[model samples]
Target: MKKSILLFTTMFCLSLVVFAQQNKEQDESSDTVKTIEKLKYKQQPGLALAASKIFFSDKRYSISGFGEFNFIPVQNNVNPEMGDLELYYSSLYRYATFFGYRLTDKLIWNSEFQIEFLHYKTEESHYEIVIEAFFDYLFKDYLKARVGFYPLTIGYVNNNDEPVMFYSVNRSEVERLIIPSTWIEFGTMFYGNLSPSWSYALGFSQGLNSQKYISGTWIRQGREIRFDLPKSISINPQLNYTGVKNLTLSTSGYYGNSGQGEFIEISGEPVEVKGKINLTSAYAKYDWKNFRFVTVGTYGQLGDTEKLFELTKDENGENGQVLGKEVYGYLMEVGVDILPYLRKGRPIHEKQNFLFDTHEMKLSLFSRFERLNTHNKIEQSLEGLPRVESDMEIWTVGLNFNSRENIVFKANYQHRLNKFNGDQFPRKNIVETGIGFIF
Candidate 1:
């Protein structure tokens, strides 16, 4: 742990020197004023990097990567008898490399190769592979088309998973458990701007695999080319409005049939099941001065659960066949950039106070609260089925220190507010720290 901290500090200091040098060079250049003005309204480099692959760009091709390292130095259990203070390295969260080519002014090709290392409680570790390859064509300002494997446009976190884009050391529990961050699938989509402040996206994609859909964690069903092929199809649509200054409001939904023409033998007879899934969500974000706030709510439902249960009963056994008919979750967060108060000076340029700007150093203190219920409702007919009480509430307080728009250091304390299924579960409070960078 000490070694890690030392390494992080050294790199952080070096990054500051490099940033200072870059800024100094910019100041010496003739375009200093223009550059500063552009930075004032520009989004973080992290977002720009992600979008550059599919959107308009002058360069013929480019390469970029992002990575994050996390550690948990302290974990206090509520029950003394349960365990002592625990400490360990959390995981090498994400290592992703991207390749993008601009075939023409209106055509682009992009691909991403990513690997994530996850550690389990039993001192075991494994790696997961993620890939996103897609092609996009610009038809006009109001219409465009994209096809191939891409991240699902379900919520804010999935598309914006870059470490520098969020204030918390870890993503929200609701997004992880309910919305399923990093969810990706093969699909074709059409998106366009409706007006200066409004936009929309619609897509059709391969649907979930019911065999993998377990209990309240519906997102686990995302089939990423693991099976021979998926028979189900999903339709998703989203709308966004940014008409209000410093505010963004958006909503998205997903509907799909998960069964994919699969059949199972029940009571010595062949039975076909069509498990349908539906999800809807709405969210809003607002920025006022140095303060930022966001709220999101989502509801999900699965159809033919009773049949799905019977079909999987033999293969998964009785204990593993619990699939929720309904699920829901919500999250709320607020943050303040305290660095402006600590530094005694005016911004470098006008429009520098825009919430999305990331050219300057930022120090933020944030808090988030969330609730998730994987099995909010179940079919009454599925009697004798053991239901796992997958309901949870969580609170997190954190600090984010960004040396530059693409490099960040984070620390946070998280508390689990609700116990799972009574005294059998242990409640743990965790202290987490991490460093993230992109280039």
Candidate 2:
């Protein structure tokens, strides 16, 4: 752990040094701002970089930010349904200032330090500050390697941040609360193009226990049970293929295991419980210039051994036994763009004109569905819930307005249903509106 931390520090310092050198070079090359070179951003990551390259010839210093506010008003009966509502937002929200800089042509650093209320609550608190800062090496024109605290590159939505692109003002509620966006952890990764129309990325990241809760105390062979902390690792791989000029398809998968060690007291003696979790997932997506479709599915299981047991003085003593359970889930989404009908405002293939005419606006209608099942004892016990299965289905249909790749406006109506305990949750619905931008 010490060595890893040191290495990260050293790399960060080295990148700073390189950035200074590049700044000096830029100063010597030109005194005043000039039109940006066309291919300067061909090797860059996204629109932010490309836009910054346009404003600041020096890649060493770049500035960018985005802000958004969402409102959800519920109308109907007095008792608010408990299911599917946790995913919806009721008031003010924002993901602002996010900034990044290219230390050198081969290395870049980015951060998504955030400030927002938890579910639009009145109280405020610090969320995660350090988003992602890593050293990337461009091995070839299309291949790259990165290491540091970065979001896992699993699905299309997982890889995209709020500012650059998103199908909705907020991500699918299923993915937002469950999968966690801007979810970063220490890890290493490799990304490159497989062919002209296909690209791929592979990486490994620290894993966490999937159990939702904890019950009685457990010890592992005389030692107190310490919940799993970076004990397991995750494997993520993705493949993207461009089927046509405007259509793209992608598939990705993730597999991991979580490890926890514990110790318990049995009739005056110390006992132990070591739990292991296995998780796996696969997803596919299709993007056509203005329309999109996606499907994702995942499965996980937890296993552990009883190892020891105690009984009353006159009661029969029990031997150690093993306990385990399996859980599974899946999600799907489909949407279409309405901006295609908004009349093409400009020709992208043509030369640059005024700022407003340089890009076009697009709108889309989308829907998403999700489900989860925990049918075994191991799962129920681990989550501190009964052995009852829980599943949720949400339907969202909305319109999104995106203009010049910088500003976005959205409005959507959502209806969600929960299926559990043989009682179908009442259909809950809400209307949401939002605005966001990137620089």
Candidate 3:
């Protein structure tokens, strides 16, 4: 451990030296206003370099972050028979910072730290987390190696989670429930470009633990991302194509055993039950003039659910907590930026690669529809319970405005629908507003 610490310190110091040298070069270039080309960002990893330009104009290593808060001023359950009405919720939800360094032309370090739900009443505190901390070595244009804790590169949000990247006050429900966006793991990965417009990644990591699997949320509770060593091993692979103008197509998958390093008591005796998860997703995104469209479809299957459900029924003593054999999700969205058509606006000036314009504004009107079911299939029937606790369909209409790329203000109306004909559960309607900034 001591040797590891010393090596890290030395590399960090050397990175500072590289930054100083780059700054000197920038000073000598044309500098009424520094553009991206003046300071060398191409030496960093691909996505990290893009995000850095949005977070900082010139300071890449200094602390920079994005924070967003939301408010729900109106909420109601269309039917009163479900239960007592919920007041909805609000908070200073997410504050995340980037600490990235370019150690050398062939190496880089990237990390993100975050705070969630910043609210207190003298007895409660928020949650702190390390979203990602990893190192990458660039050996060639088509291949690179990475190790450390990294988020699974399964979807767009999991890869580019900055607030400015999405128009919703919150992220997509499909991404949250089905894909479990921001899912991180400790592992080694190899990723790189196949061509100027194609990229791919393949990695193996610590897998989920079926011991924690619950009914309504499927494998979400089984992530084992906290203080536990999951014994199972998992692999995720992805391929993406961006050859068409303003269009992107991608496919990704995850396969892993969901059981490891744990035991469950069944019939007053200890037994080891095994399970595994198989998931796949397809995505297509397009832009035509000022209009944007996106759609995604995902399906997943779990093996050995009968044994897992019996264990869940014993531990939780609730049929609603039964295990699921399958889960799936679907999503579609369309939006248009009306600002450019309303008037002629100055595009943010760039020098080949710099993404900065302090005052350029954007306004978009968008709508999204999602349908998901965690318990789409089960091996055994619950003797007494609601059909499924996690069956849900949601749609929302919203308007998002950006004073600049780094600052956003938004308002939206959302309505949720469930199965069971009409009102076995509540159909909730809500109005919300939000503000987010990056610095």
lDDT of each: 0.68, 0.50, 0.65
Q: Candidate 3 — what's its lDDT?
A: 0.65
How many clashing pairs per prediction, in order?
0, 11, 0
Of 1 and 2, the candidate ahead on lDDT is: 1
Could you give candidate 1's per-residue lDDT for residues 21-110 as a string of tens digits?
A: 434424444454311111221332113354343343345775555667776642233332221111122444566766778888888888
Which one is best on lDDT?
1
The TM-score values for the models, in the order shown, are 0.81, 0.66, 0.78
Clashes of 2: 11
Residue 306 in candidate 2, Cα distance off native in Å? 10
* Per-residue lDDT over 131-236 for candidate 2, one digit per residue giving the tens place of the 0 to 100 score: 4455666678478887766666544455555543665556664354334344555677888887788887787876543232221111101111222346556787
Weakest ten-residue segment in model 3 by summed lDDT: 79-88
Estimate the lDDT of model 1: 0.68
Best-fitting candidate, scored by TM-score = 1
Give the poorly placed runs of model 1, Cα more than 4 Å off: 1-56, 73-89, 226-229, 310-318, 345-359, 381-388, 422-427
- The TM-score measured for candidate 1 stands at 0.81
